[model samples]
Target: MTYPPQHAYPASRTPGGRCPVAPSLYGPEPDGNALPAFYEELRREYGPVAPVTVAPGVSAWLVIGHREVLHLTREEADFSHDPRRWSLLREGRVLPESPIMPLVGWRPALLYADGQQHRRMRAAVSEAIARIDGHELRRSVCATAEELIASFAARGEADLVAHYAQKLPSQVIIRLLGLDERTGQQLIWAITGTVAANADSVNASRRMGGILSELVAEKRAHPGDDLTSTLLGHPARLTDEEVLHNLAVMFLAGNHTTVNWISATLRVLLSDPAFRSSLAGGHLTVDDALDLVLWRHPPTQHFPARYATRDLVLGGRPIRAGDMLLLGLAGANQDPAILPPDGAPVVGNRSHLAFGAGPHACPAQDPARLITRTAVDTLHHRLPDLRLSVPESQLTWLRSPWSKGLESLPVRFGPRR
Candidate 1:
């Protein structure tokens, strides 16, 4: 859901990552914790649909209404998921080396395709993910979560971001995709590079693509019941590139979203004394807490590149063919109509845009949530006294327009049992 970070490309490329064409503004650059307020301001001023520069010289519509998000997702015939349909990219307006390139650039994967192509690819991944047994998945998640917590629970303190929050999901995803532990660990760093849109992103992406291709080949020769093997055995007969790309997409998407949500939820639990006391003393449930996080700090504050397939009006604003559309998932969840002063409804309201909607909605959401919730419960149950090790202001967020992640989450806890 998150776009890659915006950093300078090579000097042969634009060091500033700007097109030098006086791009229209999105706002003051998004500093940690400033983005949500900026989104609020945009909604107040521009209503649901607002215009902002995506990258240098590239402007797009940001859809902030809950209904508008559903509308765009539901009205796929008018709005396309295909980045190839983006006129800017088609006309060479977006630079090949631009930081946003890897995020907005077209790949023959499920997230970027439409019509029958989308259906075919989606069916492959969907069926594969659906085959995962819920009970077994939870067991795997618990095993990983427990192992990680055990390693650090005995220590009075640990940076949960590094030792726990980040490790559990990556390892779970690795196990699901049949990646060996070592290779999975290595690839996690590569994904960090690519998601940050660092100058080395190209090399990182190449490394990821290569590793995934190897996994695809391994599954082909000796298929197992794992998701990778399940994909290999699907009826669509996807090419090596398609298989590798889709797998890579699943891995990265899983890591990016899960890591952010876990850390964000932990940040809230530790930083907000009143909210934590209520949840701790049974006045509020964990489901309520997770739901609030899903609404307020969705992993992707500004999702990338849902292009317009044809000229049309949305939220009473004129949107032309090929105009880039960014779904304001974080904003939509707080749309005035749906969210009031206190916040969103607690229990049983599944109306948030965190997992998106429509045909392209995240297929792995159930498993992803199960894994995250399990991880949370494991830590809380094991280390009931866990709390922050540093001041709240000192903890910085990942400074990426496309992402909402804590740079690190340091904490201390009672010694392990």
Candidate 2:
């Protein structure tokens, strides 16, 4: 099948025609390669609030403008992150009444929850993440980064995505969660495979979920002072199943997003010599690097899907209770009204929606930022000559619309001193 060029828009969006609104928008099959490009053009044509079909029988109001997305994110009354709501709207059946709900018995976590439950989960996780001594975590992360760089620097070559970007975050997260090396690797593989943009990777995710379920049971019987244990200890508030669900979410969310940021950031750095020089000169701190990375290329291109719980008006469009809403985080980030011109590269001290907004925002933002900052800083110091081994066009882009990331990134650099 031929994919559209990077800038082509869908023909139906043009004048005097009704766009196909059903399966084209909401069907389970992966969206066409032209979708992102189409969305870009629609943003130009329809402004921030555009009508799009996300799945079959599931229409959504796409929020493309930065300010509007921010408003929707913070306005819990208008937008609901509850998967049950979305599933009900898409399937035309209430979630709890569905067979899957009974079999899986999914519970909403901070990412998918709102109100007091979300607040409590965020508060608990935030307290733990914030209390982590940055300096100490940085030291450990730096050591890991340095070791990784040393392994590849001598060859003057590396798959930056695999050798450094992917490795560092998983290692740091495993250490932070106090998981054994074997289990940590298993978790990483499961999360990565399950969430891959490729449809072929779905089976891997299923297998990983099975393993995680078993691991959750083990943790219950023999708990330790890790994040898992902390979650389990709060049984009054969270059920055992809820604890497992949250852990699975955390593992998948934390691992891949950080990995994507690092890979994309390195690609950006290699392409922009001035940025690389600035980083090497110590003009850019870890926080600065993270901000730039996030602003330029957020890991998740689309916001977590949300459903309208009640009739509402967004961007002057009437949104029914069952309609799906695809909050375009990437599109929002680039919205000219909310951000500076697209040509300007991100520098220091800017906030973007890479971690999202409001109650459903990623709870692990602090730790993620810390891990990314440490990896970038450590690499810049240790591998001053690091550069991509392959041409940019040769690098593979993951095809899924859910996340923006590279499949692999090969690089060449001078040997470690």
Candidate 3:
């Protein structure tokens, strides 16, 4: 699953052009960290499938049931990923300039492709990611994490979210892609701007495209042992434009989700004493902590619109042709069908819908796991006393409809002597 680009919140409306009476899931809450509660409420009130407004004049079903999400995602023939099939966008109600376009907009990337084309693109991406050496990547991630933490270790205090969590993933991905430091820096800025989806988003999108195009050309002329070059040499024989778009997909999707995953893992490590003590007492491992976060506070709360290719009923709700279905990933993980009521998160359960399911499941989960675990492990090793500087309640989550990214993670620890 991918994140919806950050955008301004407009007024709310449901389908059929009527004033929205259903719960709206696209705006900020009075409590910045109330996403869990909100998901629970939706599930309790609507019985797993609830009518919700994604944007003004945009109505969709938020599928909060675990079984339903699995069925919908696996049956790609019935529920396709191609946004071109969305009825709202087709009827001129959802305009090109709409803020949600960055999410549901048609792209030539793997995220939007379907059927045979999706298989081809997915194979290319999966193969490219598979070729990377896991041990080498882990070592690179650990080293990057060490450098990031050392940069702030002497200060005794820092926003780990900004200084460490966000930077480590980008640097690791850049190294994997075999890009230079300057270009890597530029990619970071361009990606930030593009996902922000503000006045600069259009320019940021163009800038990112230009950067990817240049990298593709460079790799074509002088191939190297990197992801871009690997894609260029793949048997898929993807065109230059295809290479650029797929690279964009990998970079953009990989960085955003990994950043949030890192931040969320750190939040749990710092805020929950029992959880920290579990690690200290040897009752749990970092991998267990990671799994808990995946099940409880997933990096991506809700995935973007998946259009229904035909009329069908899911979770007792009738879905029409071309109707939008937003996968309630965090909600589904909390479903009683999977996790017993009042049950704690299972230590090694990897069945959560956090990375998605079926043919379109995220292809880079292994790399993401390595980066997150190494980052968290390195941080604790560097500063064992690290703790939150501010009260946990004072910390806020970024108010976006897609991912549960922390706004900042202010932390303090014993300064290095």
Candidate 4:
């Protein structure tokens, strides 16, 4: 965002020629694991449209082609995101705690809606989020990052995940929604569980919903300049439940995505020496690093659940009615057909589907980038000599394709310079 783009074109169009066919066999269960290695394995074994299990006994097409994902994301009439439209969910196949269920399941939020309903819900969310001015957001993020950094700067070493990365976004969200400390902490836990989609996720989701409902009610009773009050006062006149669910969507998606964005960006800065040196030497802007991370790591590995409205053929693969399609955001970014002839992505080629495209594209990307870049710049400025305490190989990531999240980012740094 702070740097010029490599090129811009209508991402609505498909790449030249036909899609290369590969075996449509099911490779493995998705299990919501967001690993670069797994995405590479899927790309190598199965071409553009490959089959994979989102949960045990639930297989769907993972759209790995860049053009294919854009097409499906753009074709709302053909591909529905509603989980209730999903045949497997109706058949009771997805367990309550299934890792992918929380995302795939229907909620009255903009993320799962389509057509007029989606537009109506999105108006309020977009309007409310748009009120977040960039300058003020940067100020908040910088202050939060500085406060967080000061706590650990004297220690000479700290887990950025525990101290800065995770908490920064949570604190930002708290400020955005204007929630108290106790409620914000509870909300963060609930969001973590819902995104995790494992056992206890269902309960966690309900708790998050309850928290959102309370926040909405409080905002309704007494207004403020925060997002909660903005939504409540919006002309959309959304129902209490609608407002609650929408807020939950914001919390779930915003915090969850930002935490990973921050963590992965920090990981890249701390782990990749050459890349870090480029920034240190002024060859790369912070936005450049963030853009690369967005393409390669993305916020989520597998963008979940778009059900087929009718039978259709995609990338030479048979798609049946009610079949779900998971867009491989990470995989699609590497889709060779859409890449340069060298099979490598040129820097600043945002043609990647990191924020997705079409009607459901992320509405809050600018805010996300601002928060991430501010956090990154603040950290690097305070801890110029920051370096990873462990090798990249030894670091463990949270097994979540829903969010490509790092579990921890431990690092050692010289005292503030």
TM-score top scorer: 3
Error of 4 at 279 (Å): 1.6
lDDT of 4 by residue, 118-221 (tens): 99999999999999988998889999998999898888999999899889989988989989989899999988888875677788888888888888888899
RMSD of every candidate to native, in Å, equals 6.2, 6.6, 5.0, 6.9
| Candidate 3, backbone clash total | 0
Clashing pairs in 3: none
Candidate 4 regions with alpha-carbon error over 4 angstroms: 1-37, 343-345
lDDT of 3: 0.81
Cα lDDT of model 3 by residue, 198-309, tens digit: 4566677778889989999999999999999999999988889988989887887899889989898888888889999998888998888888889888887778868988
TM-score for each of the candidates: 0.90, 0.82, 0.93, 0.90
Off by over 4 Å in 1: 1-29, 341-345
Model 1, range 219-331, lDDT digits (tens) per residue?
Answer: 89999879888887899988878888888788878888998888888888888887788788998778788888888788877787687777666775656777788888887
Which 10-residue window of candidate 1 scores lowest in summed lDDT?
7-16
Q: Count the backbone clashes (under 3 Å) in each candidate.
A: 0, 9, 0, 5
In the predicted model 1, the residue pairs found to clash are: none
CA lDDT of every candidate: 0.78, 0.66, 0.81, 0.78
Candidate 2: lDDT over CA atoms?
0.66
* Model 4, global lDDT: 0.78
